[model samples]
Target: MKYQVGQRITGVINKITDLGIFVTLPKNKFGLIHHKDFGANWLHERQNYHSGQAIRVVVIHNYRGKISLSKMRVNDSQLIDQTNDFLETKKENFLSVLAETVSNSQTEIKKLEQELVIYAT
Candidate 1:
């Protein structure tokens, strides 16, 4: 029922229009995949997205009480690989940044402690 951005979801195509494709998600929830999210190949082909065609999509946006989905990001091979690499890189980079911040904080704390000792004496 409750959907979050970047969450992968499965649904059936309920309607297709020039603007976008409407998907029927679980619990009768509806979402839309805009023309921009259909990807180049699918758009180039101009294939009719028939009703009941099951699709997997990622929740790209949720705003003003509307849910927007992206089929391109979920299904694009390059994007998928890039997404994985990006996440891994972020995870790997987090530790280094955190360590640097912690080290700096410790150094500052030690300096303040030394100043406190001098002031006390």
Candidate 2:
């Protein structure tokens, strides 16, 4: 679906960085919620967000294949399971598994690189 300006999208929190929060949208797209878009004192307010969290945001800009998002009009229920303990636990478990997978991938990549060096020698 073509996301138009002013459209509201439901996406998953992919990652959080100093630059801003990255949201994973459908159709293999990622949207950016810049710090300025968060609101006043985003630097401090950022603490309230985390990876794997589902959030509702408005599409403020879409240019050059980059989608910019804002939480200006987002309602108080930022999360579908904001008060669900089971979902919170599931999120934690999913993150833990994802982290472990990344660690294992890194180790495998290092081994492959070392093998390549041996082959080159």
Candidate 3:
């Protein structure tokens, strides 16, 4: 299967070298997760990602059918910033909708109270 950049995939660690870790994806396709891809938290025990270990990675590049994967996103900071922006916008929208609903309910309640007063008189 053709792998595209930014694709998230699950694979087994097939080999480990000083430069990087190699993973075997479905269809026996292989890709390299370079040493630079390891997050700061994992740098200490980099050798621990042994063969047969299952890992989830995102494809960072595909050139001439050779695929490169990243254990951490190549653009993790940008991705996190964008995600935070989207969540903030979503929260604002939810609050606005909730406020509108509450306003409408209050208006309806006032109308009901007026009708009840008219009926009582």
Candidate 4:
């Protein structure tokens, strides 16, 4: 079975090199999972991968006989999760600031009311 770009495929690690890991795709096509594309949290390319390990990868490039894969899609999911967490924290901060402003306004109003009574007496 031939794989195309944007297609997800399951393959086995056939070899590991400084550049990338070579996966044996169906029908003998070789796919490369590049070291740079392994995401920010990934450490030790060889330790992250091993011979005969099975992985699901998304194909990013297919040029002539050369095929490239990305575990980055999986990594991107983590980034998205982190982004969502940050957004939530920002939202909470905004709400807290708004509450503090309102509280300050209420305190000012009470102070003004006390001053008016003293002036009228």
Best by lDDT: 2
TM-score of 2: 0.57
Clashing pairs in 4: none
Question: By summed lDDT, which 10 consecutive residues of candidate 2 come out lowest?
Answer: 76-85
Cα-based TM-score, every candidate: 0.56, 0.57, 0.57, 0.55
Q: Write the per-residue lDDT of candidate 1 for residues 1-121, one digit (tens) a residue.
A: 6777777788999988878888998888889998876566656633756889998988777787589988878854433332332355476688887788799999999999999999999
Model 2 segments more than 4 A misplaced: 75-121
Per-residue lDDT of 22-120 in model 3, one digit per residue for the tens?
999988799998887765644675757889999987777889879898887844553332222234556559878778879999999999999999999
Model 2: how far residue 1 lies from native, Å: 2.6
RMSD of each: 15.0, 10.9, 14.2, 19.2
Q: At residue 101, what lDDT does model 2 achieve?
A: 74
CA lDDT for candidate 1? 0.78
Give the alpha carbon lDDT tens digit for every residue of 48-109 in model 4: 77899998887777888889888767444432332222345565498787788799999999
Q: What is the lDDT of candidate 4?
A: 0.76
Candidate 3 TM-score over all chains jointly: 0.57
TM-score of model 1 vs. true structure: 0.56
42-111, model 2: which lDDT tens digit per residue? Answer: 8887899999999888777788879998776554344242323334456548878778879999999999
Q: Model 1: residues >4 Å from true position, as ranges?
A: 39-48, 75-121
